[model samples]
Target: MAWLFSLSAECGTQTQAELFLAYFQKLSWTLQDGKTITTVPEVMEDNDGNWWCMVVPQGLSENSVKSDEDTPQMREIGNLLYASLWNAPDFRYALLGIEVDLFRTLSELLEDTTIGEQPSNFAGLVLAESIWDLINRPETFQIFKPGYVWIPYPD
Candidate 1:
């Protein structure tokens, strides 16, 4: 049997980090968090400044990390951030790189997003919705192939 591990995504900042440390007492997950992944990620940023957010910023554990790789807690915070940050029902999120500064506005994300035009380079915006769908239906992931773009959002 295959042993699959799902390392939860963390969100938030400093005080949140302190709170996670306090409550969990210790976090082997964060410590073991790798600087790499197994497969070629659908979304790869070539720019500099985009480190993933690990801080909640506000709320009781405002400065804490959303979870210590805990599934449920992290899911809630992740969803909340979706509504809190953008306030858009269909908003998609992506961890952008320093080069993201080129497009100051959110609408710019859709700029030149012709899926067929750049078959070699996948855009980060569409990758977000596609991944969320994959998270919900991982069975489809097994048949995933290189160069196959999955877009959950309708055209």
Candidate 2:
């Protein structure tokens, strides 16, 4: 299956908001006490379509580096990606998207804070809300791509 991969890396003090917001919308949060929570954190998306936020959980486990190739920035990106993947709802919860973790790892790093600055290249971290937005618009996704998945649309 053809899949899209998104990754984020910091260029400086600015964080990637679009990447973060997309990840945010798809995440499901739970409390330490085992209670479920659905909190939509604050996001700033400009009129030109740039957005991001800081939603990293507190008291995360220590990060383990398996190779010398990992940089501090890369390590942090891995942490954000891990949090995104782990907290992501099952594919069933997605109306038009599927869970595709080409690979998985355990790592820790600080939350991204680089905003208002574009990176040279944004890989897997680029948001695909356009796809979701299209699908969500009154049977547009179904008409365009039939049988993509088995998720039932809200009637």
Candidate 3:
């Protein structure tokens, strides 16, 4: 279940990252149902070259503002936000488990796959299949857990 999300971005500029965060803060962000999803993004990195943030339905991560009933909505919202990165060639993301996060180019992610299309995270398919597909590669661990793997994506 997706209670919270650590969504980090590697945009061409800090403004892009800010715009990304700002996109969520707008009074809009509606879904197909004409309903809006709200996410309060807690930025972790802004001063640095990279941008990192934690997304919660309302409060910060430690507050655990999300509940079991909230998972479905969060999952859906997370899926939209996750896939939105594909809008730019430089944009990439890993829909990681609650404890981890990584950035990957859209091209890099589709590499060596039998199916050429980008795997949709429509409803958390990423949690099981995507994560497994990623971890299976011996080189992906270093980016997450220390001494693990790292599939370096082009900046």
Model number with the top TM-score: 3
Quote model 1's TM-score.
0.23
In Å, residue 119's CA in model 3 sits off its true spot by 12
- Per-residue lDDT value at 112 in model 1: 40
Candidate 1 deviant stretches above 4 angstroms: 1-29, 33-90, 101-104, 123-155
Model 3 lDDT, residue 4, Cα: 40
lDDT of 1: 0.28
- Candidates ranked, most accurate by lDDT first: 3, 2, 1
- For lDDT, the strongest prediction is 3
| Candidate 3 weakest ten by summed lDDT | 119-128
Clash pairs, candidate 3, are: 139-150, 140-149, 141-148, 141-149, 142-148, 142-149
Q: Tens digit of lDDT per residue, candidate 3, span 15-73?
A: 65566566545423566556665666544443334554434433323424245654555
The number of residue pairs in model 2 that clash at the backbone is 16
User: What's the candidate order when arranged by decreasing TM-score?
Assistant: 3, 2, 1
- Write model 2 residue lDDT over 36-110, tens digit each, in one string: 333242343333333324333222222222344333333444344444543442211111111222121111111
Is 2 or 3 the stronger prediction by TM-score?
3
lDDT of 1 by residue, 26-125 (tens): 2112112332112111111223322122222222133233344444343443333322323211212332211222232223333444433543343222
